[model samples]
Target: MTDKQVLPKVTKITAQKRQGRYNVFLDDHYAFPISEDVMIKFRIFKGMEIDDQLQAKILAADDVSKAYTRALAFLSGHLRTEKEIKQKLQENEIPETTIEATLKKLRGLNLVNDLQYAGSYVRTMARTSDKGPIVIRRNLRAKGVLENDIDEGLREYPEEQQVENGVEIAEKLSHRYRRDPVSKMKQKVRQGLMTKGFSGDVITQILAKTHFEMNPELEDEKLQNEFTKVWHRNRRYPFMQRKLRTKRTLYSKGFQSDDINRLLDQQVDSQ
Candidate 1:
């Protein structure tokens, strides 16, 4: 058949209930539906003739246009890594070829930049959370950010700033544990900072700056309070057993050995 005779003539175009999409009828039979973008791109109109070649071209264009629109919608809410965007599109069952083309389009517009996404993520976490470089790096890696991008992102957080942040957190924890023995309080702060992703060196540096002054009056009060509790709990034990148990308890609680001995001597003298 000649090309003109074989071609289907567009008889009607009607808008579907879906926003910005229309159905095209050829020879009074529904042929295909296309997005407004595709219709405009190919200048599809009633009374136009479409051969098989034109029909294939239009269908391909429509697929790409739809995929691009879906991608745009996905990106509208927040920044996303390239892998995240790909996984999202795949979840929607978009064809692989269309997904690749859509990604290319997004990259061309600088909308799918992994480096930029990583930077934004790092800055947001640094500003809003107590996360250190290790934790932030792990988070970015989980989100499929590239190693180079993650490194670049971490570079934005200076070493001094990390130490400063660590010290700030340590100070807060120190206040909470103020009643505890100095060694116990420092250990608690160190462990707390470690859980928040601070490196050992940074934690050590912060701890080095921390000063736990020996308060003789306060230490005496704390020791007496602890001794009273221990005496009550172990009152039924023999004299030697109760003394040894109290010594062990106070030592484990991080009180100084000399302080424990002096307190024990005072208790013995009183008895």
Candidate 2:
């Protein structure tokens, strides 16, 4: 009769000093350490036969268990997109296979949902931030969300809220650029709102409602201040050159050509 070889058996399972780790002894020799969750998941027990193939499978399971635990910690603070989580897991040197497995499990649990993430992000930014729908869309794209999901999320940001946000931003900008010429101020406010991601129609609406018109006395004061600055800035030039430079600069500053010429004539007459 041929003698059969006995498999290496788990002689004992001892708790490690760590909160949720254990050491497994095979045939009275220390074989490996594993997480408690992994131990429970694989039904690891003393007297369990651990052949080479079973050991490999058990270790693989532990790797995924560890990766899953880490992923959960990453999600403890805030909701994350798949790309963001993958990048983080890669940074931690988790294997691509293990990362994918962890992601699949998380997705199954609905913990890493792009659609939900996008909608929540849009609603938050629309309500709490100055970000417009376009800006939020761009942000979601950078986070690797799909277009359909982004569209679904943007539904939370209604046009009414957009217009209200636009009004607030435009009014703030109008005040910030109040010293600018009415035309210049309007131009600045328009460009500012556009850069802030306000739609063209919304910006137009904001401009129509916002009071950019200042008193004539205030306008004259602003023109005088600008003219004084321009005049002094060109003082080193000849009289003709100085007047020409001031007129050109003031005209470019959104002052009327006629007003600029009148100011130049006044300066010349005064000199």
Candidate 1's TM-score: 0.84
TM-score of each: 0.84, 0.91
Residue 23, candidate 1: how far off, in angstroms? 2.3
Which has the greatest lDDT?
2
> RMSD (Cα, Å) of candidate 2?
2.1
Per-residue alpha-carbon lDDT of candidate 1 for residues 115-195, written as tens digits (9 for 90 to 100): 999889988887788888888998999999999999998878877888877777888888888888888788888989888
How many clashes show up per model?
A: 0, 0
| Each prediction's whole-model lDDT (CA) | 0.86, 0.88
* RMSD after CA superposition, every candidate: 3.1, 2.1
Please list the residue runs of candidate 1 whose C-alpha ends up more than 4 Å from where it truly belongs after superposition: 1-5, 16-19, 51-57, 210-216, 269-271
* Model 2 Cα lDDT, one tens digit per residue, 221-248: 8899999999999998889989988888
